[model samples]
Target: MFFVYKILIINILYYWHNDCFTCIGNINLYHMRTIKLLFTTLTLAVLATACYTEVIIEDEYIDEPVLNVHALLKSHELWYVDINATSGNREVPFLQRAFTVSFVGETVFANNNIVGIGKTGNGFGLDVGYFNTANGRLQINHDVDGYWSLEVFMVDNNTIELYDSNSRTSYYLEGYQRNNFDYDMVFYDNIEYLLQEYDVWEKVTTSKEGLLNDFDSENYLQFYIEGNRSMFNSSVDPSGMHLDDVLWDYSGEYSVFGVYNDETLKTLTLDYDFMGNDYFELYVINDSTIELYHSSSGTVYKFKGKGFISYLKSGISQLDKKRTKTEYGTMKVVRKRKI
Candidate 1:
């Protein structure tokens, strides 16, 4: 019995020493040693009892904090609508059209205009609607699109999916702060849409270095989305004329080509119907101005954008606006005098 008790006491001391070592840094080293010494002395006195008592160790479980949907929605200042990542055939009109959306208190803001994307509302754009969250559902009451209830699914730390059951559509959004967001990418990727936002492009300056051509006679230009085609209207209505008062002398289709996949540098081709096509290198001077360098005549023309349109509050949804691709072939070059 003495030898058995000696073996049991040794086992107990080993277990106590291991447990005490766990607290080496947490507890003072001297205090841990003192605790082990005291525990060992006590265990020796109650060796028989300690041998009979079975020790069952259990792991303590910690519950993860439940994520609040409202807090997550407002965590980031801006949520860029990843329209290309949309998973469903159907789409939420407002979300499909918006470049970015923000949730601030009860107001819902959207950056619908690519021209004024980074500069407008300091990157939040305009308050186009209101939103409320409850029972893990986000309810949006848009000024033009009406009401919509969506279920939010977290894709990751910075990505989310707003799933609309009625439409069976999922709109993916990536969160970002205003300062860190890539505004230039958005501006160039959707540059075609920016052209449609202006009511007219009025000629402000014409460089005299290049040879004067038929394009010099054109003073006012208008680009509009018609059905599924990108259309342009050119006028010789002179400068300083009201946008609505300008008389269009020519109307045809236009195409924008990327120069060596560079977004900043683009070539615009004007299909002048039977008058042949005119090519010009396009340059964005500012938010409201553009420079066009004529390739044929080496003339440079600067046009200022007029009448900015924000599609968010304009009551125009994405479905209402359409764009289509057109293929052009070699046509007979015919130069006609401006009538």
Candidate 2:
């Protein structure tokens, strides 16, 4: 029984260590958000908790204690790790404990006895571990946003050295999306047709949810240019929202590296600031619109950015193309200029 008590303490400490980190992390990094991925998972874990009821079995039957760690670091918030005992005869005996993310950095959160009481799936409770009074589900506030990477240890004996950016919260981001922008530029002088502006983000895929930029039709996208650099608004969350609505005038700036693909003349290499974060790669559509695809989330954003260039840009003779006014008092593209 004494040996069993030792194993129990080990299991509790492994998980509670994380909780202590969380408690300390919350105090130290109050400016950062407390993002929780486990809240959604608690539903199933809570159901499993009903089967458990503090048992102290013979330590002789149990094997060496093996610990498994799972940490999810997102949105520039607190680091969290789920600690569990793996190589034991009793399945639930290993139990589930969580510690703050700092464990990867320091050994301070090594202490255990952090317990969550009352409901099994509920937040921290008074019965165990370091968080004897923490309650409710782990929460991540909406306004709090940003991202960072960490060396996370997982149960499968592998380490994820990197993570996705904050922009990819909606999609299942893959590793390829984390590449840096460093390469030779491919400029096409004649492809200035892309500089014209319009609200080109029309419905593309049928998923409806696929469209990330959903600004009002009347308040379409626009671009302001000076030299090779241009400026525009960084897309806000909830899609369809405009910076004006939030009284924010945060405009993003990007350098025009010109067309990236010589053969297609459709791809543009732009280095742009998205609320301080920079990203690259844009595609031109029939000399009318631009497209940006975030590989991580697999989301494609379209921007009319500017109106179509004048006759000088189209390389038309002006005589071949005729513009006429319709009865409704709007100009129509009746015909294009030819050589």
RMSD vs true structure, all candidates: 14.9, 34.0
Q: Which TM-score value belongs to model 2?
A: 0.25
Model 2 scores worst on lDDT over the 10 consecutive residues at 169-178
Candidate 1 local Cα displacement, residue 46, angstroms: 44
lDDT of model number 1:
0.79
Tens digit per residue, CA lDDT, model 1, 1-339: 556766876797689679877764676678768867876676577776656767999999999776678999998999998766787777788887788999987999988788788788878999888998977799999987899999998889999999999889888899999989987666555667777888899999998768878999999989987766789999998899988899999989998766543445666789987798888877776678888888678788999999887675555444465322222232233222111
Q: List the residue pairs that clash in candidate 1.
A: 228-324
Q: Count backbone clashes in candidate 2.
A: 23
Candidate number achieving the greatest TM-score relative to the actual structure: 1
Candidate 2, residues 18-119, lDDT tens digits: the string is 777767555544323332333325434555665567987866775754322222322212222222212222211101121221122211121111111111
| Local distance difference test values of all predictions, in order | 0.79, 0.30
**Best lDDT among the predictions, by candidate number:** 1
lDDT of model 1, residue 52: 78
